[model samples]
Target: MSRSLKFALLITLRGFSWYIRHVTKSFLGRGQVPVIDSDAHVVETERTWEFIDGNDIRFKPVLASARSEPNNYRWLVDDKLRRRAMLSDIDHLRPVDRNTQTPEDAREMSDIQSRLNHMDQLGIDVQVLHNTLFIEQVADRIEVDVAVCKAWNRWLADIWSKGNGRFRWSCVLPLTSINDALDQMRFAKDNGAVAVCMRPIESTRTLPDIYFYPIYEEAERLNMAIAVHIANGNSAVCDVLRSPYDPGASFGMFRAMTAVSCHSYMVSELPQKFPLLRWGFIEASAQWGPWVAHEARRRYEASGKVFPDNPFAEFRVYVTCQNDDDLDYIVGYVGEDNLLIGTDYGHFDPSSEIDAISILKSRTDLSTSLINKIVDFNPRNFYAI
Candidate 1:
């Protein structure tokens, strides 16, 4: 067939297939894709600031762009600069409704009630919410980072209590001090946090760094999972995401690099050291599963090296996958129980093209039970929900 004809036929076939699926779902009364979105995001509003201590020169994250790099943001402690920068001619639409105009009026992420409404419309039963901007700003300020994490956790605890169990947050920790991070993890767990969010790739230190062992020991003690949500723009290796065409490309590359390193640690001494600890890598596509598993086996066979008994075990660690990832290959190597489905709802970045749960449900290779396992069961197991 000619190229133009082939394109036309492909479009026609896809449309026809979609129509058939739509009608079939309608007939079955399953039009809504029911899912517990394992990695959705929440935009922090003024509510996050409600509990922050004002006496200590406290910090709150704002989207500010430097005149030097007008397209990218430079997160700083000065809320004045953060706000003035936004008001002072930034590009694109502010992440708020134009008719409202008021910055606070457009805040969806900060308000748990408003966020729940969005979830209702999207048929999302649950969401594992991560911090929007604050996770990236705390570079070296130890005291400031600790206080901010505590305040945010306090605010989140209040919301979670009133929310009647709709939101689950990954509590941020100040890694500058091991003792302080442990204290925050315990505090967050006491306040009902699902997991402790941290950077998986420590650019300064390798995976087997001794400093991390204390935190892992504490997490295992508390039975709290460590969620390595992909850090963006201004990590150790990359100053900014720097992708003019696709920012998510840079984020994906970061996630992939971080995830592979994390897996290497998991397959080696880290998991063995803290045998009770559980780790999860989020926002990174899980298609890397097969490659990592392949490389892992290749090394073990080539070198006759020591290895874990069940190398593909899903109990200790988990990775989240997008709807379009290679499912068969992932399941083949990573095991279906180890796979999780998460749509980055409300995130401005590129994510799954369709409702992730629906895509899993429609997979020809996955049985109904396996689809349920990916959508609901795995996440529950991963997060201890």
Candidate 2:
């Protein structure tokens, strides 16, 4: 066949296959492609800290309600306010239903079956839960950090036991202490965790800093991907960058920091150093990727370094894209294998597209093979599921 005829035939075959699958799923309810919700979240409750043991019990985060902000509940950790417990139910703009609209049991994973049923309704096969609390700085004190992370991991492990392999999670580590972080990573790997969650801007150290070398090494050794979620660990930077008028920092600054981390990691030789390790820039839309790659190349040349033509592929790096992102444009930079998609399930943010799977499937602009990779193949391989 001629090249043009071959391409036309490929498109026709894919369209026919999609039509068959759609009809079967609509009528028989069994032909839909199983989807992995790669960026789901679980709301941390008072019970999330119940696993804290021994003297560490003193460091258990206390849930407190703000009198000034009656709608906000937060965690007081090491005498400092941690991230808000949850988005306010009465917030006018975002609204409570954005995140907590799900049944309380399902939102908190207190009832595993409830969450599973909710996922079933959404057509999600598995949900890789990320931490809502640890997305920001937890505590300045290493002891407190260790206590909360350990408890959180233990709590997730228990939840995973009840989830029947439908729930996977990324483990949080005490970045202040490398030895302790390694210990926690080992435990998490054994207990159904497929990745280690780290903030993109972790305090004074960035992802390429020597401080994270041990983490990258251990993550590679354990076959766990380093999940650089859209978060800032430095409260000072967040305060300075987040404007008074801005409703939230996550929408703007945190995502920029994550893109910066992606650029830094790609420009630097970190990925090459930890070749076996997979790096995922989660919840940061893949829109900035090509820009970062273009900028990374400029920086590489400025420093007399040769940039890889496809850094995302050359390095084992992946990025989670939003439904609104220019998929055709981003796919050109990231290639099909390095691009993944998620619902940002459980959070009401700009990245949250509760129907991301269906949304991607509906985009006829993208080839069916590419859509399958974003919704299934890429995420499964990235998370090592």
Candidate 3:
């Protein structure tokens, strides 16, 4: 046999093996519910800003690294350095393993097919990609914000087009400029974004502030969920909460803010105001659901109002749960239908659970139906995935 023939045969066998594995995993479990990773992340790469418009080229974000420390990277945006430029920047947490089961190109999503293959391995039928850069404020200037957000949305849209419906995203907007934000939301909705990303505390405004009402109104009109991912747009708050020695203490700022957002929204009746819109409190585990619900109930009573038996259901709100969370208790406040789960794919924080779907399934405390809702039905209903 010729050496060239042997090489071709080897390639053929590898391709055939991949096909068999993919088909067996996808179709063999026809009766089983498909898993949707509600909060997977896409680590930002230099390629992310390539979609910036010609006129906005001046506002393009520049990736910079120190000469002495090769891995000390940050994004230079509007003459400022954003330390958390990429998931890998937080090396203390060991954010992501680029060359592990997932390839670097796949994790950053420069190669969409490779990412899909990794998803297949993880049993994630669809991954709702979130932005790593936009977790914190990318730019203080409105022009920069608008330009950068437009570019990011366009980049995600292109990825979605090539993903074969396996990648949905949460779109970020220039909240400072409501008009530009609305336009971006429309573009995102027309493309493949299932939700709009918001922080619990966005700059000087909180989620319940009327400043965000316009964004909420537009999101509802687009039939998109307001996904309040664990983020701190307020730099002052971040500074106060950040601990030099403890990464968990620093990261707790984001989790606490998201929980506060949920509580604030419930008390403010923001969800009721936007009746048609769905609200998602993600990454921050659902254990806080009962606490927030209880606090909201007390605030309602104090204000001479009657709190509903299930605020989450009444408000069209959903929250993500971790495998370690007490779902049996959280369910009593959040209700089964309003609970979802996620794998914080690219980041290695406390919430990061690459095998969350399988782990949740193994919980003997939860019934099969409830587990299915957390992994499948709830996420599909929340993000319309």
Q: List the candidate 3 regions with Cα displacement exceeding 4 Å.
A: 1-29, 66-68, 87-92, 95-101, 245-247
lDDT of 3 by residue, 162-196 (tens): 98767889999999899999999999999989999
lDDT of 2 by residue, 1-385 (tens): 6542343344346534543443234533654666778898998888888988878989988878778976677889999877888743623445444342466678777788999998888878778899888878999999888988999999999998888677889999998999999999999999989999988888888888988898999998887888999899988888887788877755666888899888888877786687677789999889998999899889888998888888887777899987778878988888998888878776777787677877778888888888878876677777877
lDDT, candidate 1, at 255: 69
Across residues 1-385, which tens digit of lDDT does each residue of candidate 1 receive? 6542343344346434533442234433654433567886555555565677776445664456678877665455544232122232332543432111222222244455666665665566667777665434454566776666777777777767765566677887777767878887888888768788876555466456787888778877776778877763235454444467774565554566656665666556676676556678787788777777667767767777665544546226678887668777677777777678776654434443325655567788767777877776667666766
TM-score, cand. 3 vs. native:
0.88
Clashing pairs in 3: none
- Which order, best to worst by lDDT? 3, 2, 1
Off by over 4 Å in 2: 1-32, 87-100
Error of 2 at 253 (Å): 3.0
Whole-model lDDT for model 2 versus the true structure? 0.81
Model 3 Cα shift for residue 268 (angstroms): 0.4
